[model samples]
Target: MNFDKRAQLIRKYDVPGPRYTSYPTVPYWKNEPLSNEEWLQSIHRNQKHFSSDDVSLYVHLPYCESLCTFCGCHKRITKNHSVEQPYIDAVIKEWQLYKSAGLEKSRIKELHFGGGTPTFFQADELVRLVHSLLENQQVDPSEVEMGFEAHPNNTSKEHLEKLHTLGFRRLSLGVQDYNPRVQKAINRIQPFSQVKKVHELARGIGYNSISHDLVFGLPKQSLKDMLFTVEKTLELRPDRISLYSYAHVPWVKRTGQRGFDENDLPTGEVKRELYEQAKLRLLDVGYLEIGMDHFALKEDSLAQAFLSKNLHRNFMGYTTQNTPMLIGLGMSAISDSWFGFAQNKKSVEAYIDGINKDQLPVFRGHLLTKEDLVIRQHILDLMCHFETELGVHDSFDFNLNVLLRLKGMVEDRLIEIDGNTLRITEEGIPFVRNVCMIFDQSLQSSASREGVFSRTI
Candidate 1:
């Protein structure tokens, strides 16, 4: 698609919407006192029907030394290193809680460390954490995948080497942008040299799937800025690239997005162009676009997953693995049992308190209904593959009004509808979120849209 055509589509389709990381997204979750005991039961119940008891694991280390004003993740900004051991211990205890609940024998096929800065903990501390989780467990390196998010500024050579030794091969760096003006605007001031050095160190340690994260539509971002950032990124030749739209949702409390003047940020077609032009450069360099906002080399597992139509997504975003159950062990971490969703307490202190009391730290959860499960499948199909086929026997009777709503999109060439099958056009990839929102019964039925989600461009 040309820049002009994409720009025109942006005007027609850019609107605030959920990214659909989960269907019946968080806001629609029936958090009206989820049963802690019932949640555990759901895990056992789901395991019975699921093909494998092996699960994916996500550990959220929510401590950061400084604030990145553009970040919206749940985190606490403090430079104190003393807080590390206690947090690590608490997470280990949480893992034990699940093991005691009868998951002691399940193999962890995937493990990911995500956070304010995963490298904030000492290398030895992280080693101890991984060791404890994998103790008495034998995992084949090829079958088990491990990854972590790293802040290039603070990630050390030891951090790279130690994690590689622990079976983690994927290293994702948050290189939001290399432009000084944009960096200053977002309050993340790592230099290009810093990122390059970290990249080289991780590469030297034999980390195979290195990914660089880039964001468009920042306060001072421009088409030139994006091109330059992509050019600098190409010098490193990362295996995967994530070009995310900088979601401007200052209404979200404590996100620190308010640090920048909203007026200075790009909007509408301008922001869309930043992605379109940068995408062209990546395509020219032989990178294949993954599900959304991500690209990978043809050889990377992620690209292969997309090509093979086996890609999966969860709270941690896209993944090469589609484990039936995801066990999250950390403060504010979320767990998916394929039948229910449970979240640990958001506060570090409270989470540790719950674990100390020999209790699950979950403060909120949602048990999916049969209809929700069917809707979830359709949404997943669209998000991962851009199309879905519905039959009359499908459990959830999709609303007639919902299908009628797609008339506009079909007329715009953003979608093609024939009977019960829906497919987004090649030109409509950027509007996937917008297209998904139409199928969102909660968002469509609700009376309000304010303060819920960011623009979908």
Candidate 2:
């Protein structure tokens, strides 16, 4: 690797960019309010298209015992456990709404429980929630992929065992950093001991895919600290590791990120080096890089998917499941029908109120235009497979200005354009987001100020 050349590229391209989890990212989602009837119509259309095949479900459990100051997810922090049952009831009610409204397909190909903290609820409550969602549905245990985000400090052995017994083969534990200073700065002081116990317990209960979530560019983090954290993490030998860049979105997540000093966070070349060094170490240790910020062993499904070119990206990051209809239930959860995107209300009160009134709870959404749909595919191709093909007589025409915008990146050797195809060079993998930005007409056409997204480094 050419260190000098890499450093120069990083300096030049390291700027605020969307992670490309979605083509028209949340901010650029047209700000269009979607009615319950429209949301159901989209679902009905998807049901017809999908036939009896299953869709994906993402259930957001927003309760957290405490705040992880560096977390950027939507969460409600409180010591009260009373909020659990009511929230679960509302979520189940919301799912029922979809079922009763002509969503004929109930078989779930994939189901994921995301934070604030999924294990914040008691094990029994979780069991009831899952059962409610799958009640009378055609869920084949062997065909389903189930997983959840777990906080090591709070996830009891029962939490692991119950979920495992219920067919959850994947588990992701948040281990941002083992360094005490870094943890303190982020207000997430979990020791390695706690992580080990949970990891071992999950493995003993037969969880096949265990993922550890780590972060770089956190407050007070350094190259040395990152190396040490990677070393400790490798000791665990998780099936997958997500080494994410700390997104300092204080304006959007004021209370969650304000505990740390901005100066303490690594920036620019320093932050880039942290990720590069860690990536090198992980690769050297038999972990294959899967898309951006994710590494997995050869046997992991994510790696297999990447190799087979069946990998997919969504609001839940990378996944082997590529269902056309992804139904998200709970406050602030976002659902995606191939043609549209909708988000439930962020406030728990409003979400439950709408559910109680037999409403869909979707407050906002975007119906993708023909142009938006075409650009979305190209961006997804770049993000998941690092290449995209455009045919001469393709039905969807890409913006000519987008191709013009790629001139500099192509000249810099970040990408290669051959005929109607574009491929990201090996040197351009780290700058994939920059490559995708060339096609982001929404961002290019925007008049917004800075700080809409984290730096691409």
Candidate 3:
């Protein structure tokens, strides 16, 4: 599509909405959270269905030496190395809680370390953490995928080597922008040299899938800056690229984003243009768009998954791994039991205390109803594959109101509905969230959109 057309569409459809990482997204989850016992039962049920099958694991290492003003993730900022060991110990204990809850022992299909910075810990400390989780367990080495988020400024050669030795084949380096003004605005001023060094180190250590993360619409960001960032990124030739829209949600993350002047941030058309510039440049360099806000080389597994319709998304973002269960360990981590969703205590102190008491540390969760499941599947289909089919399952009664609500989208050529199937047109891909919202019974029931989500653009 041309720039004028995309800009026009952006004006028409840009609105606050959930990314649909989870259908009946967290804010719309049932008021009565799932109990600890209920959460465990969901896990047991998952295990029963996929007996001895490998499950996915997400470990939250929520510590960073310095705060990135643009970051919205749950993290504690401190320079103290003393806290690392205690946090790692608590994470191990939390994993054991799931083991006691009947999670398949030593059988993991995918493991991801996300955080304030997974590279915050020393090399040996990471080894200890991975060993503690893998000890006496069976991992699907052939199919097992392990990865982590790294800070280019702090990630060391030893960190890459040690993690690679532990079967971690993927690394996502946070390189939001290399523009000095933008970096200063976001309070994440790592030089491009730092990122390049880390990238070379990881590649030399045999890490197969290295992803560079870039963000548009940051405070003081411009089309030129976005192009420069993508150009510099292509010079490194990462296996994957996560080109994201910088979500400025001061209401939700007041302190972390306080460093910048919101007035200086790009908005509306300018922000959309920044993304289009990045997207075009990346595609020119042979990177294929995968799902939303992500791109991968044709040889990358993410691209392969996208082509095969096997791509999956969860709290951990996009992945090729699909498992009935995902166990999240550490503060503010979330677990998916296929039938339910549970989140750990947000505070490190509270999480550690709960773990010491032999508790699951989950303070909130939601058990999906049949209808919720059906809607969840449709949303996932649209988000991952840009299409969905209704009335294909007995669990759901096809709601015509959805079609009625989306009538404008059809008229706008953003989507097509033929019989029981719905497909998002190429022009509709950017508005996939808006398309999904038509089927969101909860959001529709609430009928008030103020202060609930970031804009869909």
Candidate 4:
């Protein structure tokens, strides 16, 4: 199909869909019967799978100096530096509880620092925190990969150098947009000079990978504005680029996105055009598409992961490793033990209260059923590998449910289905979420349900 036809399909199919960061996404988790004992037991049972050294760590630092209106992440917008030490203390305490539960520190293969802004903390504080973690754990530096998210406006050279010295080789800077008008609308007044400086600074300090986080479909974002952002991004030539579609979920985030009206944001066909133009521009500048909403130059590790078929997806988005055990520390973090999923309290006060009481901060979780696990595998394959084959199983019968759902998509030339295997065609690339929704049993069951997710297109 041609661009015009593809554009039309995108407009028609670009309805609300889940990002599928996790199966039975967080909202669907049943927390009523989730107890600390069950969570710990699940962790122990899943740790056995890490005998070959396959575990990942996600450390969430939820503090930020200010709130970006377009952000949908869980965060506490505060300027008080005093909040930092207490949060770090709580995180370390939580880690201690996990350590006491018999999780061998040697099994950790990847560590990622994500949050409102990891660079919000002082450089010395970050160094101290990381050092303490390394001291308590038996981490293999050679096999470990560590990275963090930084705000370009406040990420100083010292911050980059300090983190780099502490085994952090990858850095992601949030550069949502370069347009002054768009920035004002989102209340994120970051100058391109600052972003460019930070990008060069990270590369200059020998950081292996530097990723720029860009967003499309924001309020007042036109094709020209997107072209400018892409052109400016190409000039910097970061190692990786995460081109995200702006999720306008005011009903969920509430206050964070209330500054602007929903109608001001780009809609169906226009939004699709913005993405297509950006993709073409990035490709022309030598960026290789790596799965959904992410692009990496040929030399980047993510691109290499694609080539080796080792690319993996988790709550933290794309990863290079397929670790079975992921332990999340800090406020509102979610832990995946392969067999189960647990999330800490979203409130900082509640997280602190649990830590002070010597309790695991988790308040909710789900133990994956046989069907959940099977569906999760299919979703992961489609999200990371872009293809999946169904296995004959007692719980889920292999039939035309998926193919039947894809029939419309197939007619639109969005996907092509073989026997039991399905692959997202090039035209379907932008609508990957729509393709995956065919296998999303939970979503289908809750389709009539209000306030679920944003459009997949």
**Please, what is the whole-model Cα lDDT of each candidate in the order they appear?**
0.88, 0.89, 0.87, 0.85
TM-scores for all predictions? 0.97, 0.97, 0.97, 0.96
- Taking all chains together, the TM-score of candidate 3 against the true structure is 0.97
Query: Model 1 residue 158 lDDT?
Result: 90
lDDT of 4: 0.85
C-alpha lDDT (0 to 100) for residue 170 of candidate 1: 92
Worst 10 residues of 1 by lDDT: 391-400
Off by more than 4 A, model 4: 49-53, 136-142, 392-398, 447-449
C-alpha lDDT (0 to 100) for residue 65 of candidate 4: 90
TM-score of 4: 0.96
Best-performing candidate as measured by lDDT: 2
Candidate 4 lDDT, 1-457, residue by residue in tens: 6777776787688778889889878878876447889998888778665554466889999888988899999999998999988888888888878877776454567888999889889998888788766665665545788999989988999998888877788989899889999999999998889998998988999888889999999998999999999999988898999999999888889989998887789988888788889999999988999889999999888999987889999988999978888889988899999889999998999999999999998989999888888888888989997888855552434345766677888887777778767788887788888888888788777746447687776
Off by over 4 Å in 2: 50-52, 392-399
Residue-wise lDDT of candidate 3 within 381-427, one digit each (tens)? 88888889966762333476776798999988999989888999977
Worst 10 residues of 3 by lDDT: 391-400
Tens-digit lDDT string for candidate 1 (284-361):
989998788999999999999999989999998899898999999898899999888988888889989999998989
Q: For candidate 2, what is the TM-score? A: 0.97
Q: How accurate is candidate 3 locally (lDDT)?
A: 0.87
Name the 10 consecutive residues with the lowest summed lDDT in model 4: 391-400
Model 2, CA-based lDDT:
0.89
